[model samples]
Target: MKKKLGAYLTNRKIMATALLALTLALSACGNSGEKANEGSADKETRDITIKIGYQKYGTINILKADGALDKRLSEERNIKIEWIEFPGGPQLLEALNVGSLDLGHTGEAPPIFAQAAGAPLVYLAHEPASPQSEGIIVPKGSPIKSVADLKGKTVVLNKGSNVHYLLVKQLEKAGVDYKDIEVKFLPPADARAAFEKGSVDAWVIWDPFLAAAQTATGGTILVDGTDVVSNHEFYLATRAFAEKYPDIVDILLEEADKIDVWSKDHPQELAEKLSPQLGIDVESLLLAAGRRNYGVQPIDEELIKAQQAIADTFFNLELIPKKLDINDAILK
Candidate 1:
């Protein structure tokens, strides 16, 4: 009876050990499943749609319509391209600041205002100044022959834009006090309407609006940005995005460079392509395309200094809320 009891005790110990081992094995399998799910979740986070913001007035639209960027980026990395349209640079930068846009392009002044507004931004590349692309224009047969003629006259412009600086510099150059001009702040569409109806004596605008306005209203250029502001177009990304996904930044720059070259080489084709997409006349699109400098360049010290000057100009005029370091916005 003692031997049988001892044997029973040994069997009981063996059963307990087997049960413990089975429980551990089941837990291990569960852990492996969880880990596999976690890995998949991480990959989903990494491979996401890249959101790009662009305005209607530039070559970015041309690139978008071409579908090259979509094919190249999507096929190469299995990523998706999402394009967001903005009315103007200021609006685009606003979206960028709010985390809605990861990448965008804007004029020199928009980035300055964006940085002053405490937006985390980095300048990725620049389009050389296309001075002729923007102009302070007057209606046909209007008496406003010169920038000085704009004094005491209601002049309409898009506030906080590249042309804003142009208006300021042109006024200063003409010895017309900026305070003397009855400035009407409006977007391109409204300003164009005002210009045509003779409600506004002058309209300061950029391309294709400049081209469209001139074509539609027979307006003449009073003064363009030839010797004044660079009117440099800037490609920007969130500082966080730039730091986190530098490889993507390189891809963007590469694609942009290719588009720039293509646009320059095929102005007529570009105009034809953009005409229907933008709903503007082909002639106007051609004129707008011809004047623009579609060349993409890396930021240099000279460009940085030029940008800083714009920042200082706006701050001194109390246009922007405060002064900001342009260098802070440049990617290292």
Candidate 2:
């Protein structure tokens, strides 16, 4: 009887071991299925449609036109990109302010004015100043030789632009008051026509507009912002967009860094590449390309202080309607 009981107990132990193995195998299959489903969900989440805005002069233009960013992101993730372009900073920022755009690139001045106007935008990146890119240009034969001589002449320019501060700084350096000149605000296309038609005596602008005008019209640059001011450009996003898509912003900045490096190393080559987009010759583009500071950097307190200085000058001169605290618009 003892021998029979021992055999029975041994048989029951073997059965219990087999049951444990079967239970674990079933759980493993269940987890595998759940993990596959989770992966599918992740792929669906990455199928984002972010709307980005750009200007021809910005470094963002370089990356988008070259197809580098899209190519890289598409390779790594499931995503779609939509690009919307505008002529200049003012219009580009206008789109962002109105909730029509997600991200935009603009010169320092426009953001100040836009923020003052209650545009719900915030800074994401800062491009350091390329001082030589912006300045006051007069015709080769024009008697208005100096910034001081600019007094009482109609100066055509994009209002609330980077060059606006250029004009102010130039005037101060030349011992001419900011109020000395007649300011005629216009976009680059209109300003170019006005300048050529002799509608305006002097043109305060930034390159490649400055470069194109110089090469095409033999316009002599009277002064550049490099001497007294740094016209740092900025990338901004609508608060709504920035909040919704932090990952895309990282991707943009990453690509922008690559383009910036390429632009600096191959200025002439970059000009050739950008010619079709800008509607200007590579030679002319090269002339102004050097003036552009292709530094892709994050927004910081120093950039904020520089931009605030511009705002203060504008308010003191009453260019914008009211005072602006530039730091308020910075996202982070």
Best by the TM-score measure:
1
- Which stretch of 10 consecutive residues in model 2 shows the poorest summed lDDT? 1-10
| Residue-level lDDT for 312 in candidate 2 | 88
Instruction: List, residue by residue over 1-332, the lDDT tens digit for candidate 1.
Output: 22442353355446545754655555567877545554332234245798899887675677798888888777766778899988688888889899999999988888888899888989977887889888999999998788888879998987778888899899989998889989998977788888889898988899999999888888899989998877899889999887766656666766777888899999898888888878899999989988888766777788889999989988998988888888898876
| TM-score of decoy 1 | 0.86
Per-residue alpha-carbon lDDT of candidate 2 for residues 143-189, written as tens digits (9 for 90 to 100): 98777888888898887777877787888888887767789889999
Clashing pairs in model 2, backbone N/Cα/C closer than 3 A: none
Give the per-residue Cα lDDT of candidate 2 at 246.
57
Model 2 quality (TM-score): 0.85
Which candidate gets the maximum lDDT versus the true structure? 1
Taking every candidate in turn, the Cα RMSD to the unseen true structure, in Å, is 16.7, 15.1
lDDT of each: 0.81, 0.78
Clashes of each: 0, 0
